[model samples]
Target: MAAPLSLRAPAATPRLPRLAGTIRQPLLGAVAVALFLLSWWGATASGMVARLFLPSPVEVAQATWRLLGSGQLVAAILASSARVFAGFAIAALIAVPLGIAMAVCGPVRAVLTPFISLLRPLPSITWIPLTILWLGIGETQKVAIVILGCWIYILLATHEATRRVDPLLVRAARNLGAGDLTVMREVILPAALPGILAGLKVTLAIAWSCVLSAEMVAAHNGLGAMIWEGKDWGDMTQVLVGMVAISLTVLLADLVATRLERALLPWERHRRH
Candidate 1:
């Protein structure tokens, strides 16, 4: 009987050699960074770029080390991280549900679409003036700024993601006797989640920018304050150090987010593999 045609699903094809593939990205990133540092050193060394205007990478690294030793860097990182977490957490809580509502309910989408369209184009920095006026430059103002900067985009992205969930899946779930809530909870959410997570990663980056703008205007201890202080003093090394610190912090956040996405969507990972 031809060996009872295989009943199991076929195994997924393996990707390129695992060890090599795993190391390749970081290795290339390291090489690219090395080349950038070399070019930076060359520019400063040859006097093509004045040190006063753009300090050497070595000088910035030394300044970073000194800040690290003095505990200033740690303090700034904590402060900035807290503000970002608070703001982003709030935004996500607000946006995700509302976004799903907008996606599923025509009336809700109609009501919010106009507002989102009107506000989304305004940059994070513009909100600084109004936020300061209302919230008075405290931590509240900073967190609010981050919230405004992030929530709208996240809501819109979530709406789009949720709307993209296959209509057939919804129909199937409903036919199987799933109610609206159950259909949404089990079918829509799982399908929409991958896109929502991707959007959150981007929105988190925007949150950082918003916090920086907020801190620059009226804060004392965040990375934005550090940058503004260095600028005022014309300490290129300090300025570069603050910039590098922000970049590194964002990079770390992005890495964490990428891992989280892989964890939450294992099927996506397997498909990619």
Candidate 2:
């Protein structure tokens, strides 16, 4: 007798395609990096580029090792990381609630929209002169620069994310006897969270850039300070090492943010697969 179609087991999902996709992405990235290094090494070896102007990979690696051994690299990392964290935390604290309020309340939006628009167009670097004048080249100045550079973007992003939340969800929550705070907490926030997270990831990167810029101009110690000192002394290798350090730090931060996002929005991960 023929078995009923509904009762038959579903066809087994193929694992090979998923496995290949997982392997392919990193494999391609590794290949590209290898090729870039090979080209850079070739250029240096053939004397196509002056070693003083652009140090070879080997020289840069040696400088990195020396910095690591002397603990200067670790010190710079800590200084820069401290400023970044302090400023970013303050920005997040102020921006999130204020942004949500702006989105949910017309009076708040009308008051803040013009201020945000005026500041949003300014670059982080442009504030350096004023910050130095106001804050006097201290750590506070550095932190303030990062705050100014980051908060506007975060506020705008949060406002937009909150505004994008579906009205239907709020209405449904209200229908279910939810109050203003309850609807906001349960419906609007959850719906807006994915966008808010994406914005945070981007704004964190901007914070790093802002702190580095401020450090280069005014600070005595940081990755940016190291880079500036290297340039003054004509040490391309040290400059490259500082640049590499900042890049690695940003990469680590990004990885952490990505993990946090996945943990907060597991549904998005499932949908992607």
* Residue-pair clashes per candidate: 0, 0
Model 2 — TM-score against the truth? 0.95
Candidate that scores best on lDDT: 2
What's the CA error at residue 176 for candidate 2, in Å? Answer: 1.9
Runs of candidate 2 with Cα error greater than 4 angstroms are 1-8
* Model 1: lowest-lDDT 10 consecutive positions: 12-21
Question: 1-273, model 2: which lDDT tens digit per residue?
Answer: 997679778999999999999999999999999999999999999999999899999999999999999999999999999999999999999999999999999999999988987888899999999988998999999999999999988898999999999898899999999999999888999989998998999999999999999999998999999999999999999999999999999999999999999999987997767
Q: List the residue pairs that clash in candidate 2.
A: none
Let me know the TM-score candidate 1 reaches against the reference structure.
Answer: 0.92
**Each candidate's lDDT (Cα)?**
0.93, 0.94
The candidate that achieves the highest TM-score relative to the unseen native structure:
2
Worst 10 residues of 2 by lDDT: 264-273
User: lDDT of model 1 at residue 38?
Assistant: 100
